[model samples]
Target: MSDASALRKVMAPTGVLRATINVGNPVLAGLDVEHQPFGVSVDLATLIAHRLEVELELQVVASAGEAVDVVSREEADMGFFALDPRRGESIEFTAPYVFIEGCYLVREDSPITAQEEVDRLGQRIVVGKGSAYDLYLSRTIEQAELVRAPTSPKVVAFFREHQLDIAAGVKQQLEVGIEEFGGMRLLPGHFMTIQQAMGVPKGRSPEAAAFLSAFIEEVKAQGEVARLLEKHGIKGASVAPSA
Candidate 1:
């Protein structure tokens, strides 16, 4: 088969490119005034579908975990996600197209003023269950206990509700939460820099994966990624360097 034919067969087996959009990650996606999914991820998915010459079907979900699950199970053909070693087991990720910061938010009265203080004994950090930060902290946190909120957008509220010591997630997300909830401050710097990328199920043909990898690099080099970020009014995230 020709390369184009192979790409379509593997990337859109159902004759439509179903892309999973995680609205929970406000930095990458969210519901607009009309409650429709719109953001950088949405734009990328649309572009991918156009390139594939297939109809675009967005499978919008409430959380990143849900997005990852659908793609890993082949329920969706592709997804955007924060690159994590744990998630890489089931998904083949292209080099990141964007880099976002993972930060810690704490109560104003709390003694913790630095990111380094967060991992100490007796500190309780609340994170969205199955989120990128949760997965990263789960593997790295040595002493502090992690409390899980139902979703990333709820992490700060859950932390306040439970009186946890800290809330952890995307810097933009935590900043928005602080404005809504009040009485919280982020640590001086980020704990981790999240690498956001496009992914397909590991079971897909290698040609499909290579196509996506090349697609990402092309978009980044051509400034489409930066343009999307600007169009969406996104802040605190940067286009990743070329792979």
Candidate 2:
């Protein structure tokens, strides 16, 4: 079979390429009033479908964990996510197409004035389960007790309800938390920098992964990623380097 035919067969076995999008990650995507997915991930999925000559379908989920579940079950052909080693176990990621900062948000009057101050003993840090920062903290946090919220947005509520010492998440998410909850302040430096990328289920044909990887590089090279970020008025996300 021709490479194009093989690509279509593997990427769209159902005749529709369902791309799972996590709108909770504001740096990558968002939902409209109608709850339709929008932003960079939407644009990328649309372009992928156009490139493959396949019908496009979106599996919109409330959080990244839900999107991860869709890909883990191989229910969706592809999804967008931050490149984390933990998620890589069941997902094959293309080179990252964008970068966003992960940081801590503390109450304005809290004693954790710096990022360094967060890991001290007795510090109670709340993070969303399965988020990029959650993965990072899972590996690095030793002394402080890490609290897990059901989702990223809920982390702030967890922090407030329990009076947790800190909340860790994407920088934009914490910024939104401040607007909604007040008394929240973001640390000056990033705990980590998340590399957002496209991913497919593990165990797919190597050639299939290669095709999507090359497509990602091509899109980044052609400046479509930059155009989308600017068009969306997204200030926190920057196009990732071509790999």
Per-model TM values vs. the true structure: 0.98, 0.97
lDDT by residue (68-180, candidate 2, tens digit) is 88998999989998888889999999999999999898888887788888898988999898888888899999899999999887888888999889899988888888999
Task: Point out the worst 10-residue segment of candidate 2 by lDDT.
Answer: 203-212
lDDT of 1 by residue, 73-95 (tens): 99999999999999999999999
RMSD of model 1, in Å? 0.9
**Candidate 2: lDDT of 200?**
89
Best by lDDT: 1
- Alpha carbon lDDT of each predicted model: 0.94, 0.88
Error of 1 at 78 (Å): 0.5
Q: Which pairs clash inside model 2?
A: none
Off by over 4 Å in 1: none
TM-score of model 1 vs. true structure: 0.98
Error of 1 at 195 (Å): 0.2
